[model samples]
Target: MTDVEALRQQVAGLMPKVRQDLERLVRIPSISAAGYDAEPVRTSAEATAEILNDAGLAARVIDGEGGHPAVIGSISAPDGAPMVLLYAHHDVQPTGPEELWSTPPFEPTERDGRLFARGAADDKAGVMVHAAAIRAWDGRPPVGVSVFIEGEEEAGSEHLPDLLARYADHLRADAVILADSTNWRVGQPALTTSLRGLVGCTIEVRTLDHAVHSGMYGGPIPDALTALCRTLAALHDERGTVAVPGLKSEPSDPLDLQEDEFRAWAGVRPGVEMIGEGGLTERLWTKPAAYVLAIDAPRTKEAPGQLVPSVRATVGLRVAPGDSAADAVGALVDHLKASVPWGAELTVLDSFSGEPYRV
Candidate 1:
């Protein structure tokens, strides 16, 4: 039989064991986000290392600066062959509420030819795909294989750079396959060519030293909350397109999503017009803009019928591909400071920024 056919047979034979392995992994609640216990993350990393070792690779668990563990494994290739890196994460996102799940989040259950579990579809499945592929070749594929299963991806990948730098020599490869992203749809494959970067900051507006009765100072003096809202409104024009200056936007790829499909997917109510001034793909994928993430203001129940003295809001900006996140953040800060209404005092505090990737 040809190499391809031989590998296919081997994979078919390993399906049962693969399912068992995946179920074992899905049982671990390896949530690496804030407020979750860290022990399961380490346990998941150890389990991943063991799986890699079973596939004949020399596997080890390494901890990055964030103290989250990562599993690394490798197998040598035949002479004159290329080296390939397979990347996935071992940690899973938090199960929002147990009551929402029909079955326990950690218990792997199968229904309608699908496995149900917190990490079954996300990343633990990805880990099994790699393991099964390696096992098909008996851990001796034609091309070199390097496996990197990270633990902090769901937590924003804050320490990914540090981990990469620390293991540069071992993780080096001519090509990489990131198995975290979704396929276009089931049974269809797609290659993601571009992704937008992110930058965020908190803007605090102060117009008075203390609150005053609205009846006394409402007409002449604009409240800090009002000034902040006006400043935010200026970031988007009537068309809902971002109006921030010095931000970058680029022409999008040819692929487009139909308006009806988008509406159904986004759950837009009927008769509500969509905002933005360009093709949906370009506006979403290759654009720089602002979004209000959270606002710090009193609720209606807590209102004191007084003029607000200060307001704070967290704003997030998505930097388009081919643009630098640092530059985008700088421009956004300048825009917010210059846009404050009625000479209100403004302070912009940066939270975090991530560089965009195009691959």
Candidate 2:
């Protein structure tokens, strides 16, 4: 058989074992966020390295500065072969609420052809794919290979750039396969590109020293919560497009994912239409989108019927790839400052921002 055909046959034979290994790794809840415990993250990384070693590579853990440990492994090929880099991560996002999942998020379960777990679809499957492909190559391919599986991608790869730089020589390759988070249909493959830059800010509006009865002070005094919501509401137009200046980018030609297929894949409610116009790719990849992620104002359970003293909310902006987070945030802040209703005093604080990458 031809090399490609041979590789495909080998990988086909290894699929069952690969699925088992992926399930084994996905069973562990390797959350790397600040609030979650760290041992699981470490355990997942170490276990991943062991998997790679068993596949005929020298693998071990490298301690990232503050994030979870990173996994690096290498397998040598014959001299004069090309080297490729394989990337993946071991950690996952928190399961969120238990009710949101059909099955327990940490418990790896299989229904139909797809595996269901918090990390199953994310990176655990990617890791298994890499292992299967390499093992199909039988310890060495026509090319050299190095793998870097991280433990903190979901929490932002805070320390990976440094790790990449530190191990630059080892990671140098003709191509890098980042198999952490993306897919296009089950059979069709996709190479994800152009990540939207993200910037977030919280605006706090303070009006009186303390809470007062709404019946008495509702007319003259400003309700901080109302003012905050109004300001946030103005950030988007009636069509859901961002209304802020300089935050928008040139829209690109839209991509075509079959409408019925997309709806079914996303599990959208029947008869619900998709939002925005143009190509699916253009709307998501090139345009700016603003959302109010959270409101930190007093809860109604504790909120007195009062002209509240203060209210706060968070705004998140997803800018096109070329747009800078700083500039987008500056425009957003400016718009909020100018748009505050009445003579209400406003305080805006910029929060974490990550430069959007074009992968």
Candidate 3:
């Protein structure tokens, strides 16, 4: 048989084992977000290292400056051969509202030719794909292989630069396969050419030193929450394009998503009009602008009938490729300051920002 046929046969034979391995990994609640225990994160890293070891690479867990653990492994190739780096993350997002899930988020369930669980597709599957490729070659591929499974991608990858610096020599390779993106379709493979970088900040608007009764202060004085809302609403224009000046954008390659498919993928509610003016892909992939991630205002259930004294909100800015994250962040802060109503006291807190990258 030809090498292609032999490889296909090997992959076919490995499917059952791969499924079991994925199930075992999906069982771990390795949430690296705040408020979750760190033990599960470490345990998941250890398990990933063991998988790498089974794939015939010398694997071990390494801790970064942030204290989260990561798995690294390597198998050297013959002289003059190229080296390849495989990248994935093992940590998962917090399973929000367990009641919404058909099965327990930690328990893997198979139905309709799909596996349902947190991290199943997002990255645990990525780890398994790397392992399967290594096993297909009997743990000895013609080219060098290095595995880097990170543990804190869901948490903004806060310390990734430090981790990369610390392990610079070991992680270096001619090419890197970041197995964290989506395929074009179920049967189609795709390579992501570019990614937008992110910058964000939390702004606190303080209209009053303390809450005042709304009945007495309602008409002439605007509450801090209302002021914050108005400022946020001003971020986009009538056509829903971002109004922030000084932000940068570039021309993107033409690729269109049909509106029906987009609505299905985005879960947009019926009767809701799509925002922003431009080609859909251009607006999504090439734009730099504002997005409110979270607000720290009081919940409706817990809120009193008094005027809000202060409101804090986290605003995320997606920097276009070729734009500087720091400059984008400065423009965001400037826009928020310029848009504040009634000269309300504003304090902008800087959060982590990532530089935009192109491949």
Candidate 4:
């Protein structure tokens, strides 16, 4: 057999162990969001380091300024080969409403050749990819490899700047591979070269100086909640596209994805129709999207009969490439102010921006 075939066999032979290690990682609930236990996040970092250590690298878990622990592993080049940096995250997103899950969120269950778990694919698999590649080479690769398994990526990577500054030399590489995107197909992997930035903010609408009986003031006076709902509704047009002007948009590269496939993947309901005006790939990749994440208001059970004085909502914008997040957020604030009905007062509680970048 040829050398290429031999390498393929080595990789295939290594799958069982890789799957085992991946299962080990999937079991750790490394949720980095506030109010969750921090110990699990730390445990995931240590587990990632251990996997890399077994793959013949010098690995360790290190903490950044007010950040969750990150795992770093390094293997030196034999002589003159280029250094490659592999990036992944050890932390997983919170498993929301566990009752909705078909199986336990932390338990790795195999069904029809696919593993079901919270972090099984998004990014515990990435960590194992690095480990398996090194093991395939018998712990000695022709090129240098440096691995960075982030611990708080799902929580917006809040402290990434500190980690990058502190570990500049160790992470410097000729090329970087962040294994945090979708594969082109089941067996065909994709390389993400461009990414949209983010803008998030909380806005408050105050329509009443004081709470008044909704029944008594029903006809003439307006409530803050109603005004807030109107403002949020104006974020999209009749076509369901983002109505905010001045946000950058570019067509995505055409792909072989069908609407049925997208609906299936997204778990769209039987009667729900897809919105937005673009090819599926364009809508998914390049075009801008606005989402209302949450609204902070009194619960229905404990709600008083009085009209709400003020209501606050947290919204997010996915900024397209070539648009600065600062500019997009400014436009968003302007749009909210314009959309508020009955001249309700609009106040931007806080805002955050992340500049869009392309490789």
User: Which is the leading candidate under TM-score?
Assistant: 4
Compute the lDDT for candidate 2. 0.83
lDDT of 1 by residue, 199-289 (tens): 9889899999999999988899889999999989987889888887888889986564688877886799999998887787888789876
- For all predicted structures, in order, the TM-scores are 0.88, 0.91, 0.95, 0.95
Task: Give all candidates' CA lDDT scores.
Answer: 0.89, 0.83, 0.89, 0.91
| lDDT (10s digit) by residue, model 4, range 15-45 | 9999999999999999988889999999999
2 against 4, candidate with superior TM-score: 4
- Candidate 1: lDDT over CA atoms? 0.89
Cα RMSD, model 3:
1.8
lDDT of 4: 0.91
Q: For residues 225-333, what per-residue lDDT tens digits would candidate 3 score against the true structure?
A: 9999988987888878888888889888777467788788789999999887677777878887668999999898998989999999999888999899888888888
lDDT winner between candidates 3 and 4? 4
List residue ranges in candidate 1 displaced over 4 A.
1-17, 97-104, 108-116
Error of 1 at 164 (Å): 2.0
For 1-359, candidate 2 gives per-residue lDDT tens digits of 35788777888888888888898899889998889999999999888998888787789999998779989988774688778899988898998899988999988877997778898978888888777767887767678899999889899889988998999988888878878656667877788876788888988887777888999878988887888878888887777667888776756765657778877877999977666556777777788878889888777788666777888888888888888988888888898888889867889754768777775
